[model samples]
Target chain A: MSNATKSVPDAEGRFGEFGRRFVPETLMEALDQLHEEYLRSKADPDFQSQLDHLLKTYVGRPSPLYFAERLTEHAGGAKIYFKREDLNHTGAHKINNTIGQALLTLRMGKKRVIAETGAGQHGVASATACARFGLDCVVYMGEEDIRRQKLNVFLMRNMGAEVRSVTSGSRTLRDAINEAMRDWMASVDTTHYILGSAVGPHPFPMIVRDFQSVIGSEARQQCLDETGQLPNEVIACVGGGSNAAGMFYPFVEDYDVSLTGVEAGGRGTQPGDHASPLTYGSKGVLHGSFSYVMQDEDGQTQDVHSISAGLDYPGVGPEHSYWKESGRVQYTVATDDEALEMFQLVAKLEGILPAVESSHAVAHAVKAAQKRSPDEIVVVCLSGRGDKDISEVARLTGIEM
Target chain B: MDSRISAVFASLKEQNQMAFMPFITAGDPDLAATQQVIRTLGASNVDMIEIGFPYSDPIADGPVIQASYTRALESKVSVSQIFKALGELDHEELPPLVAMVSFAIVFRTGVDQFLSSCVESGISGLIIPDLPGDEAAEVFEKVKGAGLDLIQLVAPTSPRERVRKILKSCSGFVYCIAVAGTTGERERVADSLLDQLKWLREETDLPLAVGFGISKPDHVEPLRGLADGVIIGSAIVRRFQELADKTLSSEDLQKELTKLAGDMVTATHTK
Candidate 1:
């Protein structure tokens, strides 16, 4: 990959016309303040040093880039590599952004931090950061998600954070985001909202993508060190496309390397049955930015289903939408059964229990490998561990663990 | 610049009365009931009507208004359906109609298409709470070309300079959020409301309409001379929710809305 260059987003936090501030007037000043602080911090060496220290020591950064020999042999084609973000402190890439935002919260002199989560990975990560820094934390989670991700809820509560169950709308990530936005509007004076992904209004999408850029940077360097060349393709699963954006942003300027984003195909390509926004959606504003979203003709968001709770969102990140439009990233989908098959295949062959979300990427990588020559290499971002999903998988397969 | 909204405010000013604007979620009880709600408010003494365009996610709304969106969605109401229902109403009977929709609803249907639909359905103005200041400049031209007023919001936290910039592009009337929070009922209006209104009055001559927590008739007394209008939303939606819970008839809901509308208009006569 070429040396770092700041990508498409302009000064106004726009990737073409996709990213803009569509929030209430009350939150405008706060967004401006955040944007200013972030720009200043981005250039400060001290801020970078401190953040790098925490990422390495506290969150256990520099996660491995492991070559999957068995998987490569099974596909009988390209060499497969896995960016092991599942080994992070909270078992997911979510800790990367939370650590950065929590530090920013302190810099802004805010005493409290709030966030919204779907599968509770972000909630746990945010709570962990707040607990480490001795700050107050509150996470809004959908009631349905709280039921499915009970273990993550317990982890968050154990870290001295308050978990509020949101019951409105579809009772999922979308509703939790609504509740969190309302909370921020009411308490913008003393609190900072730590958005979970590479989405939301201006500065947030840019900020999150920056924090997560570490993934792409580290993987790019590791792949060069190990193979003496850049990987042929970089792949990651896209919920709101944070991990994928993080893993792909650094490689975007590298024209030779391909970028593929896998979305949850759930049951099929039907709108309501799948969460593949980029595959089958129209351009509409959702969660405060214009992106590809599954909406009706009148602009109401449609309910999305996925075996992986983390990918059950109706919209993709604005930058991802832009990349897809520019033909930089080839987007694809993996169904529930395909992801489950990959999950079992990875666990049995590599002794790694991949999260269902990450399994989507594995499913696609396996297919891509079958189509490529043996000299080519593909890197799949292993976003999170599957311990939290073991029971759900067990129930689906009707097996006693 | 003279539109139905400005004309309504001008007529109210001549009568020495404050404009009473009542808000209701379209398709709350169903498309048929929503039609009745609009017609009921029209027959009342209110000066203008604000129809809440139901979106699946309304982040600017509190529990009462949020519940209304869910109920509206459950009834399978769409933006097209709301416009269809509004097309059936007689334009002569209704006051100037403003649709309080989200930006997504308009962008999804294509802005020009949405504005043209509003014109065909007799919608006089639009209030997108999510479209903050200066950002609306992009679509301001298209809105003007369609002869529809694009209402702008002025928050309590807005700086004086920001308020000036917003008013430069604002039309119909300025929506002054009574509090810094989402729409819901509050026991008392903020003490700084009068100062905020005074500051806004110095910025532009556009008629000011205070909303977002102005839920009761008594809330209008303090703003009688300070603002041109007061918008009551969540309180009215809460009343409809209570009736729906009890399985009451549409006529019962309309009757209650009429009484509340009358009481609010009476409160506008504090002088």
Candidate 2:
């Protein structure tokens, strides 16, 4: 990436028409303080060296970009490869961003870290980071999510983080975000909000994408080393579009590579159907920034449905909205039924049980593979392991054990 | 006017009709429609307009209001938009625009900036659902400095000490969150809570507005003799949604709101 393109989001932290500081007024001074602190710490060689050391040593780095040869043959089309983010410590790419932000939080002299979680992956990652850095961590989860993802609740608690169940709204991800924001507002003087996804108002998306860019950065080199060329297409499923944004960022300027984002197709495109914002939603603002959203005629947000708790959301990352508008990346959808099929297919063939959210990408890859040349290579971001989603998938699909 | 908010409340009280406080999420449905709803409510008999600054999680709200908030967030309503919408009401004879929002939004917007913006936008009062009285001192000072009223809430579960604290900081009117939980309509207001309201009436001279569980005309009428204002949230929001079909025009919505306001006013004034 050229300096011009790489610095697209400048010191002010803008990503084209996407990133900007759209935080609450109470958080302005603190956010400004954090921004200034982050800039200084990012520029400090010592800070970079320490962060790199942690990313390499504490949370395993250079996660393999393994070509699923057997699975590719079984699919009977383009060769498929997996950018194994599940191999990362804490079992997902969430750790990558959390470790970076947590280190930045400590460097900024913050005493505590607060995070909002949906499936609790980010909460666990943030808790893990806080444990390593010796910072007090608080995680806000929706009451409903806490009940559904009990294992994650236990995992976060075991990591020595205070887990507060938010009983607001549907007691889901959005509610958790609200509670986290409220907590941050009250404790901004000493707390850092380790946002889970590439959403929020401004600096968050830019900061998280930068931290998660390592996924694509590593994949590019690894893919080149093994295949002697970049994969023809890359696919990732988007919740807040974090993992997809991470894997797609380094390749944004790589014109030869095609990037596709698969959104949750929950039931169908009916009013109460899925969380496929890109395919079905229109441009609107959410979480302090303008993005695509599913709303009613009165402009009220509608309830979104998705088989995967992780992807069941009403909005996408602001950057994804920009990418969709600019035509830089294509956005598609995969129904819960289709994703389940891919989930089982991958488990049986590759012997890897992929997260239901990741299965959306796999489903998209399967569809694309059927149409593409047999020799073409496609890199699918295997975002996380399916262990956390086993019960949910089993319940939803009526498949036991 | 010593306090613009107090002046407005005093005017409503003099009319012998309990204040008709209509709560609408700014940008619900859409920003344009929200502006229209405000104008519609303003032109109607509404004594005060509580414009909800939509938050992602409204723990204090029921399904109808929660759904409205979801729409507002999806529509990308922001604190800035609330100020802008209020500014647009400059030419019209607007009912005082009092912000009904979560503490997070207030904090995110910045305490002083939010107050200053509210003042500049001609907002008469502030209602932060999550700002318990104990944590409201700093915000109260700011709101006072901006010459706007900080409306404090007294929930059913609030202890006497908390109520005293809330009464001390509150101006304009004391918002009684009729129930222990968040905002929504209920089938009935408990007799014990009514007795509590009677007790509260003896404690403070500030006009009291009973909210949360109020839905029907009977709900408004019963509280009329005891409270200074009857704050209706979820029911009105539900009515707005019911009238929000694409086929219905803004004029139609205004007519619907006018009828709803008329019924509420009738309930409060009759007997």
Candidate 3:
């Protein structure tokens, strides 16, 4: 990777016509302000030193790049490596972006931080940051998500964050985002929205992606240090594509390295049954930016289903859309049963409980690994731990938790 | 540059009266009830009417409008359905109709085709809150070429430079977001509204119309001299929300909505 990646986004925040500020006029100034501040923060020595300190001490950076020997032997064709982001504080890569945004909130002199969460990982991470900084935190989670991710909800509450239940639409991640956007519009003066994903309007996708790029940067160095070469392929689950974007950006220009993003396949290939927008959606807008979205011919968003709440969104990040369009990254899907199988297998075989979201990547990696030569290597980003999902997993497998 | 919208605002300017445009989701109750709502507001001395195309994710709208869109979409209302439902009613019976739709919908359907559809449906102006920056300059031309006006939203938070850019692209009028928030009812219009009105007035000849949180007759009075028009959304849509009770007939809905609109419409005549 080069020292700079040409800032993927142009002045209008568009990654080739994919991402732009498609929010209300009221939020335009804030978006512009955020973009400017983010750029400045990226270059400031003090900002970088402070953020780096937090990453190492608070969030516990340089998560292990472990060789999954049993899984590699099971595949029987290629060696597999897991970038253990699951070990991060709060048990997910969500903390990486939230901590960055929370710091920005203080820089902007905002006293409050608001966020929308799907499976509660982002909510917990945002709550943790606010607690650490003594800032007010409010998290919006879908009513249905709260029921599924009760433990994460508790964790967020424990950190002094107000959890607001969103009951509109499908009562999931998508609805929570809508509620959060409305909240930001009403409270833009004193509140900063710590959007959970690398999606949404303008600067958000770029900002989140920048914060998350640490994943790939660390992974790239670890693979080089351990194996003396870059991994053959880098893979990550695509919820709003933050982890994937973070893990993929550093390797985009490394032509020899392959990048794959795994999306949720839910129950079936049908639009409503699956959240695989890149696989079977038209170019439209959801949340804020223009991206691939599961929608009807009349342009209304379709309800999407996913076993992993994190990937249940109707749209992918604009950067993913651009990458797919440019043929830089190949995107695939993993069904509920496939992810669950990998989730259970990883727990027993490697003593690691990969989040169902991350298992999507593992599912694809296992398949691809079996087809490659044993000398070749594949690195999968285990984005988060599965503790928050244990109860839902039990219910799905016909066990009483 | 546009025909119907410009004419409506010009005639109001001559009379020194502010235009009253009441917004309602096109299929709030159903197409039949929506027709009655449009006809009722049209006959109640409104200068123009704004019809919202119900979207599944209306992020810029408040709960009242969001629920209204949900009701409309759940009833299986389609864009063509709304256009076909209102196809028989010509502009003369409806006044000039303006469309408030997401740019995502337009981009998905192809910008030229969406504009042509609006032209066919007799929609004279458009209010899209989420139109992208680059697409705006391009679509603004297509909208004018299709013989319709583009009404861009300008918030109080919009800086002077952004306001200038928005003013350059806009045609029919300015949709002033009275406060820095999504569309909803408010206890009072923000005091800073007068200054924004003055700032925009000094920038362009386009009419300045305030929306978002302006619900009652009192809401209109505050903007009497400063605003060229007043847009009532959530306050009006909340009444349509009552249609969910199923006991109210379309005529009764029209009567109730008309009485409410009549008072607010009268309030627009600030003289």
Best by DockQ: 1
Enumerate the candidates' DockQ scores in order: 0.83, 0.07, 0.74
Q: What is the interface RMSD of candidate 3, in Å?
A: 1.3
In CAPRI terms, model 3 is classed as medium
Between prediction 2 and prediction 3, the one with superior DockQ is 3
Quote the TM-score that chain A achieves in each candidate.
0.98, 0.95, 0.98
List where candidate 1 sits over 4 angstroms from the true fold. Answer: A1-6, B247-249
Interface RMSD of each: 0.8, 9.9, 1.3
lDDT, residue A149, candidate 1: 89
Higher TM-score: candidate 2 or 3?
3
True contacts kept of each: 0.80, 0.07, 0.72
Screening candidate 1 with a backbone cut-off below 3 angstroms (N, C-alpha, C), the clashing residue pairs are: none
Question: Which segments of candidate 3 are over 4 A away from where they belong?
Answer: A1-6, B132-135, B246-249
lDDT of each candidate versus the true structure: 0.91, 0.79, 0.88
Candidate numbers sorted by DockQ from highest down: 1, 3, 2
